[model samples]
Target: MTQRREAAIEKTDLTPLAGAETDVAPLGRQGLKPPHELTADEDVDVTQWNRVAAMDEFKSLVAEKRKFIIPATVFFIVFYFALPVLVGYAPKLMSVKVLGVVNLAYLFALSQFFVAWIIAALYVRAAGRFDEMARNIINRLKSGRE
Candidate 1:
């Protein structure tokens, strides 16, 4: 082997440790085994999945999520785009000073960061309720009550 190649390998600590077990696969032109060749234990039941999907509780959960998500998405989109749109169409209004040097445009731009954080916080709070509803649905399914 080249001196440079040996030096590089030593620097990387590629040498196997003493008394350590290794199950390294042989290198081949095709590399590792194809994903399809890998086997996983079957744990999911199709009937259970279908039952969950058909439940009114699940439908309500989806609707509850959409109620918050749809409006939040729309509001964010409008707010994000409004800056550029206002700057282009209403430059005079955007340039109006609010503080000593900071204008409405600067304030609005800075507010976007706070708005995004607020939205994230709101989602986290809402997600807790969504999780509780989902848990109740799962418990009902597990107990075979409905």
Candidate 2:
């Protein structure tokens, strides 16, 4: 068995597969260097990052993101868990008919999808502002004004 395995391994091609090159930019390239292509100098500078993190603008950016994220996360968690919780704890209340045969629970469950979409839309809108703030920071860094 060992000899047979060794013979099979010897017969197999050992050459590395060539990846198809494209003109398309690497995934998630918003003016950031591709991970695989970064050199020692291009790699993240801890001191620089620390300096930027200490900046009031960067601090505010972090706070702003946290403000949205924390509440959104909490709300999503509550909204998602509420369905099962309510159904389990308050069956009769959930069973009441709202529109023909559909109960309050069904409506509430269906509404979660819309709520998620609304949250996503809000985040998308908020992200545009966040991106602008980030761009401003990057510009400041590049212009040596930071």
The model with the greatest TM-score is 2
Q: Candidate 1 has which clashing residue pairs, if any?
A: none
What clash count goes with each model?
0, 0
Residue 82's lDDT within candidate 1 is 98
Clashes counted in candidate 2 amount to: 0
Off-target runs (Cα >4 Å) in candidate 1 are 1-44
lDDT of 1 by residue, 9-113 (tens): 777777643321223444653675354433221123445778898999999999999999999999999999999999889999999999988999999999999
Clashing residue pairs in candidate 2 are none
Please provide, for model 2 over 1-59, each residue's C-alpha lDDT reduced to its tens digit, 9 standing for 90 to 100. Answer: 33444466665855332322233566777785566665433345546778788888898
Candidate 1 to native Cα RMSD, angstroms: 11.1
lDDT of each: 0.80, 0.80
TM-score of 1: 0.66
Backbone-clash count (model 1): 0
